[model samples]
Target: MRIDRTALTDLAQGAAFLGSGGGGDPYYSLLLGQAELARVESFELVPLDSLGDDALVVPCGWIGAPTVSVEKLPSGLEALAGLKRLERELGRPIDAVLPIEIGGGNGLAPLVSAARLGVPVVDADGMGRAFPESQMAIFNIRGLSACPSVLTAACGALTVIETDDNLTHERIARGLSVALGGIAHMVEYPLTGREAKDHAIGGSVSAAIAIGAAVRRAREGGDDPFAALYAALRDTSLYPYAGELFDGKIVDLERETQGGFSVGRVVIEGFGGSGRMELVFQNENLIARRDGDVVAMVPDLITVMDRETADSITTERLKYGQRVKIVGAAAPAMLREARALALVGPGAFGFTDAYRPIEALNGWDQG
Candidate 1:
């Protein structure tokens, strides 16, 4: 498939939703992708199954707080620099590139790199939705090595990491991001085509585009965008269930960019004396509570979006008094498995609550 300007715009919108209130905002990435579109008409998106068994596929994205990513821009050479360095280390040309996660700016990031490197992007990713740490990716959960990964900054500094521990790789990468000025681009979890097909979340790229297009078309057609978004998400195999969790105004907010992550929470009160909902985050929305009762938690996706426009409001972008709708979706089945839960469930973030499906919690299963 080819990604044209329209598709790119849809992708930006959809990726922001998939970001689950993290993965950084897609606004700048949309502009960057548009800029690239001016030079080239479209970006090539190849399916994972199309690659040869031994094809070298690299997953790439920007790392750091979404707040900083909005301010600290890339030099356009970061992805290419990282990919080239990785090629040098691997002693071969890359067959394709893919988004490390199909969420927010990270989803659009690899397009720039793929365009520059003249490689096609695989229609899949490690994380179906955004997460705070690299070790949380499905690749790591599935026992893939993240080492020999390359990190590049806008300042032309490059570092190659080689650690047996994926957690250590994330730690070193996070430190490098802060030292380099808050944000940087990374190409990690290099995969063979077979590995990508086996473990990566397939069709998420096209799914995001479809979800974005649905909302856009709904808005253009005088229909409800949020309804359209939920329908679109449910229509996709990647995100099976989705619904509005709450509709309210942000009454309070507390956010801080610390330890290479944007951590905070927002309190939202429903209209006309309705109950309140609270969301906590570490780069992405981790949990949601309604009137102090847990309604949804991590590993499931929770996103705060403009109530009227349906645009996602990331953690960094949250503001008091903003009217927003909290939306929740069931994560991909692969992420809900026992082992995967140990890596990304509510307990993984230090919550004592056991894992529960959003559908079950919200009683969506009855309908």
Candidate 2:
């Protein structure tokens, strides 16, 4: 399938929701995707099964604090340079590319690369939702090596990483992002088509597009956009359950770019005399609580969105006193497995709580 300019906004909107209040601002990447479409007409997206067993499939995205993207503009050269270098190292041309994470602006970065590099982007990704660290990617959770990765900066510098350990790769990459002025593009988890088909979350790219388009169409028809969004997510195999977790005004927010990440928390006061919902985030919203009761946690998707327009308000873009609704959705089943949870669950972020499904926590399934 081909992604055209007409579907760009929907993709951005859906991707923003999938980001769960992280993934950087969708505006910058949407603009970049638009510009690329203007030159190439449409970006090619091949199905995961279409790839041959030996085909080289690389996953790529930006890493570091989302705050940095607001001030530092990407030159659009990072991914291209990094992809070329990867090809040289592998001694094989890239058969296709996919987003390392399909949340926020990272989802669209691969389309820009595919358009420029003449390779199709697979309809899959390593992270079903955005994660703060490299080790959180399903690639690492599935025992895939993160080595032979390429990190590229906007200033034209490039570094190749090779290590037997994924956690070490994350530390080195995080350090480099800090040293490189807080953000850079990364092409990691070099996978053969067979490995990608076996591990990567399938149909996520199309799922994001569908969610966005559903919201847009609903808004245009004067229907409830959130209803459309929830319905769209339920229709997808990856994110099967969706609902609003809380509705309120942003009463408090604390955020900082620390250790190459945007770390912060937000407090939302419910309308009238209702209690508050608090969300702690590391790039992506990790854990959420309502009236001190644990309502949602990591691996599950949590998003703060504009109440009226249903626009996603990412972590870096959040502000005090913004009227918003907090939403939650169950993560893909693959990410909820025992193996995946050990790496991406609350404990992965140093939380002591055991992982709980968003649907179960909220009793969404009972009704």
Candidate 3:
């Protein structure tokens, strides 16, 4: 599928829904993507089965603290800069662009890159859900290297990791991010179209646009936007679990920006029960365990929005007295396999037992 400006707009909206509460702001990312679209004449979506096994594919993305990105705007050439450095390091022409992770911000980063560099972006990504660590991609599970990573910063800091170890590459990149002012621009994960199809979260870009459009339509039709989102993701066996809309003041929120990531939690008290609910976040909302039992966790979409406006809120922007509605959606099944479970499952994030599907947790009263 060829993506045009309209598609990109829809994609940004859908990405916001999938972001699940912590994938940074989609607004800025969309503006950047739109700027790129004006320069590039077109974009092509290459199928996974359409390329040679050894064809060179490079994934480009921005990594750093979202809180800082708001104050520190990019040079507007970061992804292009990072991709060029990687091409120089590899001594090979980049065959295509790929998104390393699926999130509101990262999800659309490559579109900007593809438009700027005059390259097509593969219709797949490394993780269906956003994760903080560099090595959390399925590429690692498939025995791929994270280096020679071509790391770039907004101010023209560039370096290459020649190490074959993903963990070592992660450590190097993390340090570089801190040194470069709490954020690093990166272009890595060089793979082929065939490998991309075999491992990536397929059709995600298309899915994003479809879901976004559905939500828009639902609102126009006087239907629930959440229900529209649920239907769009029906293929994934994921649905939104509707709970009480916490239209109360945010009593307490503790946050710390560390290691180029935002980590924290928010506590909201119900209007009547003195019933308190806590949401834990690390770049993204990982778990929304009410009182005691775990209500939702990673690999599932846990999102917060305004009770009246339905505007999505980022974890970094969450305040101490925000009336928000908590909505949970299922992630794609690609991230639900035993292998993915090991990578992003509850235990992977240090939770005790494997997480049950969100629908199961909802049981009979899924509303």
Candidate 4:
């Protein structure tokens, strides 16, 4: 499928929601994509099954503090440089590129690479939603190596990482991102078509676009955008369950860029003394509590969005006085499995509570 300008705009909106309050704002990537669209008519998105068995699939995106992404400007060559280097290292022409995770701005990172490299963007991603650490990616969770990966900075520096351990790869990449001024594009977990088909989150790109389009249409027709959003999510095979978690005014926030990530917590005061909700984070939102009761946690997406517009407010963009709605969606089925949860579940973030479905916890009918 060809993604034209309008679909690209829809994609940004959808991807922003998927970020779960991290992944940096898709606004910047949307601008970059629009600029790229001016030179290339449209970007091509191919389904995962379309690739040949031997096709080389590379997943790429930016990593670092979301706060820094708001301030740093890209030189527009990060993905291009990293992708070109990966092709050289592997001794073959790259067949396709996909986002390492499809959340916030990172979701669209591959489109720029696709336009520059003249390759199609695969409609799949390593992580169904954005995660703070590289090892949390489904690729790594599936026991894949993140080696021979390229980390490119906006200032003309490129480093290739080769490690047997995915955790070490994340550490090196995180350190490099901080050194390069808090953010860098990464090309990692290069996969064969078979690997991608077996492990990657399929149809996510189209899912994001569909979500954005649904919201856009609702707003245009004077319908409730949130309703449209819920319907869109339920319609997708990836995120089957969705609901509005909370609606309130942000009253207290303790956010700061720390240890190469946006680490902090936020408090949202409910209207008319309905109690308050507190959320903890490390780049992406990790957990949510309503009146001190655990309502949602990692592996389940928790996003903060503008109450009226329903546009996502990335972690760096969350402010103390904004009226916003908290949205929760179940992670893709694959991420909820036992093996996948060990890396992305609440325990992974030090929370003792076990993984629970968003629908079960919220009392929303999945029917």
Candidate 5:
């Protein structure tokens, strides 16, 4: 499928929702994608099954605090430079590129690289949604090695990491992001077509596009965008359940750029002095509490959006006095499995509460 400007816009909208208040904001990414679309007609997306078994697929994305990414723009050569270096390192041409995560800016990030490399983007990603750390990717959760990964910054600096330990790879990459001014493009977990087909989260690209389209149409038709968003999410097999978690205004926010990540929390008070919702984050939203009760947790999708417009407000974008609606969606089923939970569940982030389905906790299942 070819991704044009319309699809790209919808993609940004949809990706922000899927990002679960992480993956950085999609606004800048949309601008970057639009700029590229003006030069090229469209971006080509190829299915995983279309590639040869031996085809080399590189997962590409921007790595850094979303807060920093908004201020420090890319030099437009980061992705291409990284991919070119990886090609040199492997002594082989890459057949395609894919998003490391199909949420926020990362979802559209690989397009420029693919265009420069003259390669197509695989219709899949390592993480179905954005996670703060590289080790949280499904590629790592599935036991894939992240070593031999390449990191590139806007300043023309490049580093190739070769580690048997994925966690250490994340540590090294995080440090590099901090060193490089809090943002860099990465091409990691180079995969064979076979491995991509078997382990990578598939169809997330198209799903994002579809979800965006649904919301756009609802807005144009003067329908309820939040309802449209929930309906659209429920229609997809990837996100099984979706609903509103809270409707309120931001009362307070505590955020800081720490260790290369935007870490903090936001407090939202209900409109009629009803209650409050608090969300904690580290690049991406980790958990949400309503009136001091755990209503949603990680590995499940949680996003805060404009109450009237349905535009997702990422962690870095939350501001006091903004009327917002917190939306929650189920993560891809694969990420909810026992083994997957060990890596992404609330416990993984130091929360004592065990993983629980968003639907179950919010009465969405009964609804």
Candidate 6:
């Protein structure tokens, strides 16, 4: 299978939806992917069945805060640097560049790396949506290790983490990210095409393009983009429920800016007996609760959007009186398994109960 120009938008949009409210903006990644596509010509659909068991596949992504990616901008050398470093350490040529997670800026960064490195991009990815930590990838459930992982912060801070366990890698990377000023650039978890096919979210890159296309068509037709998005996602059967529609004004936003990550939360007051909602975010909205009850949690997509426009608002860009809609959607079934749940469910982020599928929590009435 080959990804054409029209398919790129579908991938980007689906990724944004899957990003579950914190994968960074898809527009930037789309532009980046488009540029790379123009240079590379076309992306080959490397199916999982095509590779041998030991085909070398490396996951690539931008590590810092999404806000930093917008302001500071990557010179584009950092990912290549990390890729080269990892290849040297492993003493093998990386056969393909795999997307770490779909959504946000990280999704497109790998395309550039693939084009520059002249390697194919595996059709699958570690996470279907953007995840905050490095070790949250489904690969962990498959018993694959994160270390021997290589991290390269854009500012010339390079480190090779050799952890005995996946949890340790997440801990160490989080600290390093904090020390790096809240965000860093990294490439890790070298795997093979066969392993990638078995472990990663299958066809996620292609799915991103398909979702982006559906949204683009809606826009072109001058129709409702959100409704069109909902229709497109039906192809995936991911979100089975929608969360409460909260009308709130941002009363307070406390952010800790460091190492490129702006970790913070936005407090909002319910309108006309609607109650209150607090959104906790670390680069992405992780948990949301109303009246002290968890309404949405990780492994599911919780997005804060302009109530009217439906456009996403970044954690750092949120401000006072910005009317927003808090949306909760069910996570992908591939990620909803017991193993995946343990890593990304409500408890993984310190919430109490296991994350209930959005469909189970709420009716599927997104029309």
Q: The CA-based lDDT of model 1 is what?
A: 0.92
Give the Cα-based TM-score of candidate 3 against the true structure. 0.91
Candidate 4 local Cα displacement, residue 178, angstroms: 1.0
lDDT of 6 by residue, 71-146 (tens): 6655557778888888898899888888888766566667778778887777778887778777788888678988
Residue 124 error, candidate 2, Å: 0.4
Candidate 2 lands at a TM-score of: 0.99
Residue pair clashes in candidate 4: none
Score every model by TM-score. 0.99, 0.99, 0.91, 0.99, 0.99, 0.87
lDDT of 4: 0.93
lDDT of 2 at 70: 83
lDDT per residue (tens digit) for residues 1-367 in model 3: 7777877777787777677765567888889777767776456766656667787888767677777766777787778878888888778888888777767688787877876777777777777657777787778867787777788888987887778888788788878888898777788778766677687777676667777778777777888876666677674433334333234556889888887788888887777665666788878888876666677777877777766555667787788778877777777776777887787777876778678877677662454
Query: How many clashes in each structure?
Result: 0, 0, 2, 0, 0, 25
RMSD (Å) of each candidate, 1 decimal: 0.7, 0.7, 2.6, 0.8, 0.8, 3.0
Please give the RMSD of candidate 2 to the true structure: 0.7
lDDT tens digits by residue: candidate 5, 260-294: 99999999999999899999999899999999999
| Error at 102, model 6, angstroms | 0.7
Q: Rate the local accuracy (lDDT) of all candidates.
A: 0.92, 0.93, 0.74, 0.93, 0.92, 0.72
Q: Estimate, for each residue in 224-318, the C-alpha lDDT of model 1 and write its tens digit.
A: 99999999999999888899999999999999989998998899999997999999999999999999988899899999999999998878899
lDDT of 4 by residue, 42-152 (tens): 999999999999999999999999899889988889999999999999999999999999998999979988889999999999888999999999988898889889999
Which ranges of candidate 4 are over 4 A from the true structure?
Answer: none
Instruction: Give stretches of model 5 more than 4 Å off.
Output: none
Pitting candidate 1 against candidate 6, the one with the higher lDDT is 1
Instruction: Tell how far residue 335 is off in model 3, in angstroms.
Output: 2.2
